[model samples]
Target chain A: MTVNAIQTRRTDPYSPPAEHLELQGDEPVAFLDWRDGRKAWAITKHADVRTMLSDVRFSSDRSYPDHPAHGGYVPGAHKGAIIAIDPPEHSAIRSRVMNEFTVKKISLMRPRIEEIVAEALDAMLDGKSEAELVKELSLPVPAMAIAELLGVPYEDHEFFEHNTAIFADSSHTDPSQRVEAIGKLRDYISKLVDARMDARGNDILSRQLDAGLDAEEAVGLGFLLLIAGHETTANMISLSIMTLLDKPDLLQQLRDDPSLIPGAVEELLRYFTIAEVGGLRLATTDLEIGGKRIHAGDAVYGLTNTANRDPEVFPDPHTIDFKRGARNHMAFGFGPHQCLGQNLARLELVVVLEQVIQRVPTLRLLDPISAIAFKEWGPNYGISELRVAW
Target chain B: MSAHIVAKRETCIGAGQCVFADPDAFDQDDDGWVVVLQADPASPDAIARAKEAVNVCPSRSISVLTRPEPGAGTGEAG
Candidate 1:
């Protein structure tokens, strides 16, 4: 039995680490060895990955030692962090706030989201022909959106976005800096939750409070949203733009037909599958996956990045096709813990692409894709900086 | 025969793919459970969207069933 070491380095910018993709073909459910001496199962096939994720037998509870999903942070200890819990508890907390992100609710946010995108673009394109797209556009759009969603005051936006960028983009900062940012953001959210308790508002935090969530739970929920909402979306925003600018033909496809932008966004998500480790689980009971019998008490990883490229599910999986309508991809993940803000993310991407393509006729990448710094070590895969000019 | 959409709310994880697929046919209740707004799709576009909803639903909570149209299936039809 051969155990392949988890490969984090990507030989190609548009694909997962080569070893993982190789494993997807040679051994779809391969044994894995982690750098920290953790032995686990890595499932890379699309069907198997979905089965592993949707089954409650594969526990998501991260309280146990050697849970592979932690990535050095133990969010399982945090109250109301639904992503770290399972079953009734996870559903209980998720239900409390899920309504805030419903398709109807998020769709209602389109006008405001468009305004936010326009504002970010306005700032980025104002009095300038070139700017680093990450700092100028990608970072701020999602940051401001999350801030408004949480009712973070206009005055605190700078502090909130700054700390979140440092904390979320772990590849760019030292552990201590990331820790400091988390601490600062936690304290800010705690204080804000306290303020909300005294006087409520129409925001997610206040709504959670109204739904009988105590201060700790409210703070935990708010903090999670503040971090999760912006960082992943911000990364997606930049990566999608960078991919577009890198491939002029693809970019021209969207430019030629604005209607293609939405489909292109889904294809980009499938192509990138940013979350390197998709659904990490601990087997609660013996189960068979991909014709391999696994006993209880084993750690498992559903390597979704590679799963997205599984040739069986996606024909010519390596090729990027905008019309593929790859909605079934596990990019936002699957099952109970699937991304709650997926609708919002899609809306933001569509609006951003529409505005960027329509407004910035000369937008071009200032650096080659290979020259760009990819966040290889981080929990999410994305570009650290995208320099672009109009 | 017509295609009818049924969503099992208990099994839904509120992924919202149903609504994404066919907003006219599905929605999320206030607590974010799946709500079927239209049980029988009227248009080909709507039926196609209903099928897409079934395809993308992560929980397998949605099913599209085909049954005879109301009066046409009855022997006493006018």
Candidate 2:
């Protein structure tokens, strides 16, 4: 319940792969003991996650402090807006970024996205026979693209990564660091907004200005966009690479026919479900699920990865099928906040996939799949190192 | 022919999901929040879209009230 526990945490909140799947079985909802000494239920099925998302009783409002992952949800931390808020308040903050995050709006950057991936790879593979994909390529694309979209200095990529890491790490491990990250992230966006307003380049930030959004809202949206924009995709980049390494046949299949990349990526996303945990919420009132009593103020987790792999929902859950219906898995999540950045993330993956497959025809793992390390906590679950050799 | 596209101020947190749904029909107002319009929309198709925006709102904030003229195709939604 105290900040001290998270600091010395050992394993993640959820169980490991096989047991994680078993724990998620048939049970529509189950509560986990919170690190902060509270009760929180997990929403494992796709239907349940969707239903809970729209349920007014479950607040998306940030101030709750009762649910895990919300700033205050963790002991020794405060709260942020949007992702942490409920109702029109959350809606207000989300709206500020909607224009930029809109499918059409993000789609406009297709060429820019392509260019970013191409250049990032070039730099990563410059003179090395072996390269760490996540550090060199996977992370930078989203970081750069989000930074550019928000009109932040490209040089600030390292800073954005650091702050986001701090913010996310705070949620999982250290509550105090979370505050520091939030402040830094907020400050960076504020300064960037002021700078972009004066320069008013034809970027996402300037468009918000043209649309008459105020400085705070605009900056707020930028913060959300920058974070929401990259985090998952970055994890996907590393995790997907790691997943491919675990199965060489699939990697070869992708290599032979690059056109299959998009569908393959979706399957990978659906199958991987790198977002180990879903957004947390407490029931505003009593709710019954899976023959279990869920009282009001009880916490619930929408375990998207588990839901995506449920045997009933997806036949042969363990096996990854290229032709199977790998989509409809709650990877992008479900309902209202069902990943506003889905299109952008998909586009990034598509472009990244196309570029990687075409550029490195012989790309293979420099290290064994088992050796790759994963992050201890946060939404995007991924490995620490993914070394590829050509 | 003029249909007022009003947002229940309480329901609207202004995430611009509606604005993206129908950019031509909506805009942000003076307060940097969503500006719900009461004017006649650009076309019947545009008005129909204003209704879809209703569903996309995270909060039940937006409702498109149609003020139909005589013989306007209100019966057959665009």
Candidate 3:
């Protein structure tokens, strides 16, 4: 099909588009994105997405002026962030903060994570019958965990959280305002990084400082960990709860067998696959992926949401089957640029879900599913607010 | 059965699946690169876990070589 003939699939935050699901058997489709008006290739199949992500020839360096960005966001200008850079620079920067997310290290934080979850749940229970899960439990748990990790004072969470929400909300279209929000975050993190240099704490920022990263590098690392550390996990938590409430059978299964919580979490992650835009890369050399030849400097967007639901790899991909091995899903992404904090995200989800099912036995959505506000466009896909009550 | 584990550090991407799956056999260094703790594991559980680690490795940098049984002949070598 010609690029002009390919329709831009309308995406729902909760479900993969029917158009994308139907186009699974076809070659990777190309389209001019309505938002940016840039022509790019959309990788739909699971095998193709994985291959595109792993291939070194497809560069993640978006800092270059020619790199393709969605909706006029120039990633190349935002230097020092690990996601926007390719290796060996990416590997070097990633290694400095990698130890903080190891299973053993994150497992040590389980007690504190559980405490945060309990406090949030307690506030929700004590307040009102109709509680907003996003604000109550979903946002606070990860916010607090990441705050503690970055050694940022918990009292100032509101400032950082609000700023992060602005950039994360795809509907918030004021470019100038987004730039201002980023500026505020950078200044806030810069101060924190400076303070940690004088008085090093046990948090990730202090660790980065102790490891000999300059002030600027430390700020970039801290900025990435602070924004990414909480926002993605918080959204995943909110989305997971909504999915469980929608499917009472799945919720009941978790309630019946608490051991199924981890498996259920994996399945939920795969089914939702929140990073709707997938990983973005500009080809460093001419490459052929899925029978399509991409020339040098071409931009390729991996549609991970579509890939996760590709029937070739996942039999009956539309259905959420907890029994299936879904850990390999690209929800956390694949290849060298896979999520740095996946272990922490997984631990937080497992703890929060298990506690909610065990403690809040009667928890159910207070609002109709149709009324829920889902984010229409953004790097991440999740609900804006999820109202739940027991 | 005993198994030999080798971690190709050059190819390791620090996904840490090996350490997650079989901590006894594999551990990460300060930089988060894989560090093989036990090349020859004695326990059957560790051996099984090592196999899982090999399967889940994103970079395919891990390898497990199992030794033949005590009385088993090496027909191929002969």
Q: Name the best candidate (by DockQ).
A: 1
Q: In candidate 3, what are the lDDT values of residues B1-78, reduced to their tens digit? A: 557888887666777878767888888876778999988878878777888788667666788888766787552210
Q: Order of all candidates by DockQ, from best down to worst?
A: 1, 3, 2
Give the runs in model 2 whose Cα sits over 4 Å from its true position: A1-16, A35-37, A72-80, A153-185, A197-199, B1-78
Greater TM-score among 2 and 3 belongs to 3
TM-score computed on alpha carbons, candidate 3: 0.87
Task: Give fnat of each prediction, in order.
Answer: 0.58, 0.15, 0.31
Q: Rank the candidates by TM-score, best first.
A: 1, 3, 2
Q: Residue-wise lDDT of candidate 1 within A28-90, one digit each (tens)? A: 887677656667898889999999998988988877665666544543257767888888888
Q: Per-prediction RMSD in angstroms?
A: 3.5, 7.6, 3.8
Worst 10 residues of 1 chain A by lDDT: A68-77
Docking class of 1: medium
State the lDDT of candidate 3 residue by residue for A17-102, as single tens digits.
66666556665545434324556777888888888888867887766656654333432144467777887888777777777777
Candidate order, lDDT descending: 1, 3, 2
lDDT of 1 by residue, B1-78 (tens): 578788897778787898878889998887789999999887768888988898789888899876666767633210
Candidate 2, residues A1-390: lDDT per residue as tens digits? Answer: 111211212153222354445556634566655565665676666557666766767766545667555564322222334565665555555555555555455667899999989988988889888887876777788877887777666677778766765554423447777777778887887887798778788677787777777777677667766566666688788777666666788888888887788788878788767665444666778876666778887777766666676777678776767667344566766544556677788889889878876788778887765455666554456665677888
Which candidate's lDDT is highest?
Answer: 1
Report how far off residue A302 is in candidate 1 (Å).
0.8
